[model samples]
Target: MELDPKALALFKEGYDKIIEGIKTLGFDVTDENFADTAARAAKGLHELIHDQTQVRKDVDALLAKTFPAKYTEMVISKHNTCFGVCPHHLLPVIYRISMAYIPTEKVLGLSKLSRLARLIARGPRLQEDLTHELADLLHVNLASQGSAVYIEGLHMCMAARGVGAHEARLVTSGVRGVFLELATREEFIKLVVAPPTTLV
Candidate 1:
């Protein structure tokens, strides 16, 4: 994707300031090895936060591809992995998402579910909010009878700072429609927690 010239200029200004800050920390910015550090960092961050509009357009296109389903069985997709930035700290968050939905008359393609999980995870966002957004998209956009999302997130802010709980993982869930039923919720939990089968 091409970067907007205005945004690139702004990012370059920010990187210049960041280079000055690095100098205060006693880093030799003039060093040959560090010469391009600021530019590389700015480019990396731009990739993470830019092109959100394109991502949304891709999501809309994905949602448009659906097939008719006469049955009401639940569809589950597990271990959809994605990376995101935490808005609070600008740190990375690793996510493993599992989703389930009971289709009414239409259902998204199986691969689309995983793609949707990754698409929604782009950019800076909170884990709790991300979980709910996935559930809402499936339930409302697809008009599913019910939708649920379970996420396991490893937040760099939690692991690299403050209390520094390196082993800690934040787990969050969201449910809509029929998934609010006790039995249905429990079944989703059971399936999500079950160990993956080993190939012979």
Candidate 2:
């Protein structure tokens, strides 16, 4: 498989550490038994750090390339689904993200909004952090008058194993700019929480 040189190097270093640890624990770890270990370790490390670094640059580039227009209306994208493991439990949290931003002089491409959601959802994450991070990206990227993001998720930490509050879905939100400045926050919240058909 193709590999990042840096990641490959780190994978080798990590592989030695893992082998040492397993041997120290008195396990009969060997090259054959541990061959896939380095690959998986590298993969986990890559996914965790990719967004923490290069992905942020991608977001920054998109923001810089955006051209502004006079569309100062609440831009809402809803029901975008997300699936991932929780940082705490490594259990899954499946959810939908809803985003809205009133453009000031700039508007991001519609699909980038979803791309942002995907980036923020990478690796294990807390649903709360996931919600706020997406909103923060939108708020910062658009430099908008208002931005709001809300997430509704069913966490495996709660369902699929635990007390089985199968009906229990968590709600998390982040509001910024005019979303936090004016009555827009309430309006956006109401609209997002309101009936679907009410929006044209």
Candidate 3:
């Protein structure tokens, strides 16, 4: 479904059409608050259509730097903030992501791990995909002995559009390697949901 020349020609016109459509429903497009809504919506939709492609990771240099060295340590990147819209309803989904992997021979710079999460998450996405992708890459790309990713999000899709029920939360996670095994998974869950009390 490529955009033909005819459609491309009407791109700006289409934006005006949306403004008019909203106006017809008794909304004021001329208001300052609505100044950039159309452009923002356009960008969000554009991102949704391009979900399959991302800034791919090149691991050659990093692998050369860290792999074949057999270093296993729990590398955790926590409290990475994410802002994205849901593909289904274009609703806002915001969350904090905590990702950890027990690296085996290869380790990424902590910032790079956060970069990977943001790369996969920028476009329109599902909570399930967001969480699982972080875990999957940490497991597969780094060849981690264990990997875990947890996401806690408030999805406006269900609250504002679907049934207008607010305050609903969506949590999704993915585990691989030792994180997939029994005892490790249990510990990970405990840490995610109920961290042990520590005196600071």
Candidate 4:
């Protein structure tokens, strides 16, 4: 969507004030290119906080293909990495997501699974919310007997502020349908915790 001219002017004003604020703090920003640089910075910030169209389009495309399930076995996609912006601080959070589903009637394209995960991770979101949203998406879209999502993230908000525990990692999960069963849940967890393969 095109931004309103009035709104753009207001945003430019805000950026100008930010430049002035830095000047008051003893940083010189009188260079000729400074205004252009500040404008770009402001535009980038606006996009990061407000833009969702591209990611939405990506998700729609990802869900475009489906086929009938031919087997009763589980399908797992593991250790997919993506990034999200934290709602509270607007800082970036790096995510490693693992997902699984047992197909009932329909199945989704395998590559699109990761694409969906990445799309959901694009905007300002909580890790817990991200996990459940992915699981729910699969449960509904695939008409699966079960679905699960596990997420591990390194949040810049926590590490860059507050008590600043640099080594901290956050983990969250969501499970639905048959995945709620103890045996099935345990099986998924075991696969997630297994050692990674190494190439010779």
Query: Best candidate, TM-score-wise?
Result: 1
Weakest lDDT window of 10 consecutive positions for candidate 2: 44-53
Tens-place lDDT digits, model 4, residues 1-113: 34445545666788888899988999778877685866676565554444467566666767668888888788999889888789888778888899999998878888889
- Give the Å shift of residue 87 in candidate 2: 1.2
Q: What is the per-residue lDDT of model 1 for residues 63-98, given as tens digits with 9 covering 90 to 100?
A: 999999977899999878888889998888889899
Runs of candidate 1 with Cα error greater than 4 angstroms are 1-5, 195-200
Give the per-residue lDDT digits (tens) of candidate 3, residues 158-197: 7666564577778788999988787877777676665434
| Candidate with more favorable, higher TM-score: 1 or 3 | 1
Number of clashing residue pairs, candidate 4: 0
lDDT of 2 by residue, 75-150 (tens): 9888777676787776667778889988878888888787777667766778888888787777776677768998
If scored against the real structure, what TM-score would every candidate get? 0.90, 0.70, 0.74, 0.80
Supply the TM-score for candidate 3: 0.74
Greater-TM-score candidate between 1 and 4: 1
Candidate 2, superposed: residue stretches over 4 Å from native: 1-51, 194-200
Give me the displacement of residue 15 in model 4, in angstroms: 5.2
lDDT of 4: 0.81
Error of 3 at 62 (Å): 7.9
RMSD of each: 2.0, 5.4, 5.1, 3.4
Worst 10 residues of 4 by lDDT: 1-10
TM-score, cand. 1 vs. native: 0.90
